[model samples]
Target: MKHIFKFLGIATLACLTWSCADIDKDEVGDESKLPNAVYIEGADVNPVTKLTVDAAGGKSSFTARAANKLGSNVTLKFAINEKALEKYNELNGTHYKLLPAKYYSLSAENLTISANNISNGSIDVNVKPLDNELDASTKYAIPVSIASAEGGSLLNSSVTKIFAIDRVLYTSSLRQNGFYLKTTFNPPYTNLQEWTLSYAIKLDQNKDNQAVLSPDFYSRVTADGGLQMKVGETDDPKAFAKTKLQPGKWYYIAWVYNRQHVKCYINGTLDTEFDVPKVETFTKLNMSWGAFVGYVREIRLYDKALSAFQVMDNLYIETPENPNLLFYAPLDKNTGIKDVSKNHHAIKVYTAGSDDATEYNQSLITWQDEKFPE
Candidate 1:
C-alpha cells in the first residue's frame, strides 16, 4: 500500500525546532519546507517489501534518509515495532505469524545522518529464523520502524518497514529416475545456430552414453562413458565433449555450441572443447532413463552461447531475467516441475508408470535434504 508519510513525534522537540506539519490533504507536496523530515530511503518507496531469504540466515540492509537536507546532524533511532505486524496481516488478508524477536536482530538501530557530508546510513537486519524452534511451513513478518529521530520528526504513516519473508530451503538435488523433463521448444530456440545449456548434477554411476541431455543420445561415443549433447539429426555427423566425470560428486555443467566449436564446462571451468562440422540439433535436455542414475538442479537453456565468466556467474543464481533465456528451473522439489523462466511452463513430470504429462503427482517426486553447494 502506498502512503504519504505524516510525521508527528517528539512534540516538544518538534515545537522547539520545526513543528511537524504534513503535506496538504490535496497533496501539495513540498519537501523544501520541512528540512528536518526523516524517512527510510528504501521504505519510502514501498513500506512493505517481500523477500525469500535463505533458511541458512543472512543480513538484509536498508538506508535511512531524510526527505530534505538536514540542518544539523540527526540521530535516527530504529525499533522493532512488533505491533505493526498486526495491522499488516489484517490489511493484506494474510495470517502471517509474527517473527520471533530471537530469530532476528537490528544491529544498526541507531544511525547518524551527518549534516556536512553523508545524509544516509545503512540499517542492517540479520535474520536466522530456522536457527530456532519454528514452523518451516508458516510465513513470517518483521516490521522495523524509524521510532524517533533525535533531530528529526517521525512519520506515523510510513514509520515501519515491513518485511514479508518466506524462509525457503531448496533441495540439494532431484534424482532423475525413470522420469524425464520435456518442453515444446519455440521455433526460434530449437533452430538457433548458437546456444548454451547449463545445469548442476551429481552422478551415481556411468554407462555407455547414459541419458544426460536427451533420450536419443545420438550415435556419438566418448570412449567408455560420459554425458552427451545432441548436435544433429539422427545418425548424422556429431560432436562430443568427452570430459571424464567422477561419480558421487556435484558438478555445474555447461554445454555451449558456438558455431563450429562445442565446449563443455565442469564446475564453471572448461573441461573440453572440440571443433566440429557445422551442425544443428533439436532441444533435448535433462533426459533420464530408468537405468541411468543422477540428480539435477537449475537447468537453464539460453539462445546465445555464454562466455566462461557468464557460466561461472550463472552457477550462483536462479531465475535470472535474461532475454536469451528460453527456459530455467531451480528444480526445487517443492515447486515440482515449475519453470521459473522468461517463458515459464508447468512442464509435466513423467513417471515410470504414468504416460500422461498433464497428470501431476507430487508423491512421485522425492526431495533430498541437502541443497546446492553455494
Candidate 2:
C-alpha cells in the first residue's frame, strides 16, 4: 500500500513539471514574435512632402520603410494611387494634377529588405525629370502607396505618401487684341551712350511701320515692312531682313548700339551691322499700339552693349540674373505687368479711351491661357 501511494505521487509531480515547462516555452518563444505590419516609416510623421525644380527639368526623390524587423528578407511593391491623390487634393484644397506614372519611378519597384536590413530598411523612389511642357502656374502631385509585401502586412493608414511639385511663376503670353504695357520712368532714363535691347516676340499680323523699342529720341522698329533701328533726330533707320514677319512664330530680336556702331540680331544670328551717329540722351520707353501687336515676353535692357555671346546666352529667358540687366519685364503677371529686375520700374495698364494722360489707352491686355507661344 505504501509503494503504490509513492508511485502515484511521483507521477503527478512529473506531469505537473512537464505542463509548466511547456507554458514557459510558449511564453519565452512567442514574446519576441511580432506580427508583420509594414509601412513607410515617415509616412505618419510627414504624410506630405514637397519638391521643387526648375521649369527646365530636374529630379526628386523620396523614401519608404518597413514597420517591423523580420527573420528573413522580404520584397515590397509600391504603386501610384490615383484615387488617393484625388482625395489628398480635395482634402488639402489643392489642385494637384496627377502626372503620368512614368514620371514617378522607383529605384526598385520590388525592393528586398533582408533580415538584417529590416531594422533600418528603406526603399528609394525617384521622380523622373518633369518636362518643360508642364504649366508653370499649376501644381502637380504623385501619391505612392504600398501595394503588397511578401512577408508582411501593410499598414493601411500609413501606406500612402504624397509628393507635390511646387508651382513656378514664369513668363506669360500676351494676346494682340490691343494689349500693351507702359512703364513709369520715375527717374527717367537719360544720358545713354551704349545700350543693348533684347526681347522675344511673336506677331499675329505685321504692321507696315511699328515701333518696338521707342524711348523718345531712339527707336527700333519694324519699319517699311522690315526690322529697323533709328537714331538721331532725322530717324536715320537701318533695316534688316526685308521678308515679312511670319505670323504665329517666335523670334528673338536684339539690338546692340553705341556711338560708333549698331548691330541687330534675330534668333541669335547677326542680322545687320552698321555705323551710327551717337545719341547723348533718351527718355522712357513707350510700348503702345505702334510698338507691339502680338505676344511679347522677356524684355530686357542693358546699360552696355552686350557681346554676341551675351546676346546668344540670353536668347532663352531661363532666369533674370544678369549683372548688367538694368530693366527686365517677364510680363508674367495675371493682372498687371512687373519688372523683375534690380530697377523695379512701375508698370501701368490703360484702356483705349481713359482720360488719364499717363495711361496707355488700348484694349485691356488679357492674359493668355498658354504662358508660351504655341
Clash counts for all predictions: 2, 4
State the C-alpha lDDT per candidate.
0.63, 0.62
Stretches > 4 Å off in candidate 2:
1-171, 217-224, 235-237, 241-243, 333-336, 353-364, 369-374
The lowest-lDDT stretch of 10 consecutive residues in candidate 1 is 215-224
Candidate 1 CA-lDDT value: 0.63
Candidate 1, 369: how far from true, in Å?
2.4
> lDDT (0-100) at residue 355 of candidate 2?
30
lDDT of 2 by residue, 148-196 (tens): 8887667677788877654334455655444345665767666777888
The reply for model 1, stretches above 4 Å from the true place, is 1-170, 186-191, 215-225, 233-242, 279-286, 352-362
User: What tens-digit string does per-residue lDDT give for candidate 1 at 58-138?
Assistant: 667777776666767888888877777777656644445678888788877788888743356577778874654664435
RMSD of 2: 20.5
